[model samples]
Target: MNRRAFALTFGLGLAALASPQAAWAEDHLAEAVRHTKAAVDHGKQGQAEVLVTHAESALTHAEAAQKGVYNIHVEQGVSHLKAAIAEGKKSNAQGATEHAAEALTHLEAAKKK
Candidate 1:
């Protein structure tokens, strides 16, 4: 009976440890969405320098989130971020804005997953 009790306690302890990792994955995903949103906002404002900078930041965190969940949306978000950076480099505000908007959509989708 004591052995049974120990097994139950051990299982519960493992579950507790797993829960924090799940929560942290969500936190990292949320952070990616936040940064992507900021990049989109900067794109809309035609601030190519700031937009590129924020897109780089968002891509880094989005990549981290993808490591935790391996979601397709996160992968798509990274693609859009790369496009945004390229457009920003050319000083093409409209193209950067469109790409950033797409990245934002992908980020939101990843958040749901």
Candidate 2:
């Protein structure tokens, strides 16, 4: 093939490969959102156990994606929130408040980025 044809073919092939990855990321993001919601529900109900579990799951999903390209702060924030919930459940009110503050910080950072 000519140089131009080769370049064009390669570019198209690369885009084709990228499209699926993008799709997968979208799916992961959706799952992360669901997990976050679950965490929130757990928190509201004072079900710290479930909140921590959901937050961890959300964080895990976030970590699986490309860090620089993805908004991982949301997951980080939720994870912290979950940590706080767990702490509260354990009767460590001060520790829970501290973690909640940290979670807010991460969430704010994520928004800035």
Candidate 3:
């Protein structure tokens, strides 16, 4: 009985270890979105670099979210953030402003859900 108990405990531990990756991914994605939102709230266009990175991270997490939990708006927001980051890199305030507007669209989409 003791041996059986040990085996059961070991199996449960292993199972938990296997499942957290998806959870971690989801956590990472949520963090990324938070970071992107912060960048958008600030006027630092150069911070787009960080925003893009976080957006990508969020995408990875969103992908890992439970299969049925598909957040299309979040995905779209990430895409918009990426484009905004790129545009900000290439142009000045006006361009960044335009891209920021686009990013806002995606953020709004995500928030609507």
Q: Pick the candidate with the highest lDDT.
A: 1
Q: Against the correct fold, how does model 2 do in TM-score? A: 0.63
Model with the higher lDDT, candidate 2 or 3: 2
Estimate TM-scores for all models.
Answer: 0.81, 0.63, 0.47
Considering TM-score, where higher is better, how would the candidates rank from best to worst?
1, 2, 3
Candidate models: Cα lDDT each: 0.85, 0.63, 0.55
- The numbered model that scores best in TM-score is 1
| lDDT tens per residue, model 3, 31-93 | 545655555654365555554455455444444542424567656655665666666566443
What value does the lDDT take at residue 65 in candidate 1? 78
TM-score comparison, 1 vs 2, better candidate: 1
Compared with the true structure, model 3 gives a TM-score of 0.47
lDDT of 1 by residue, 47-112 (tens): 998988888888888887777677888899889989998999898877987998998898898787
Clashing pairs in 2: none
Rank ordering of all candidates by lDDT, starting from the highest: 1, 2, 3
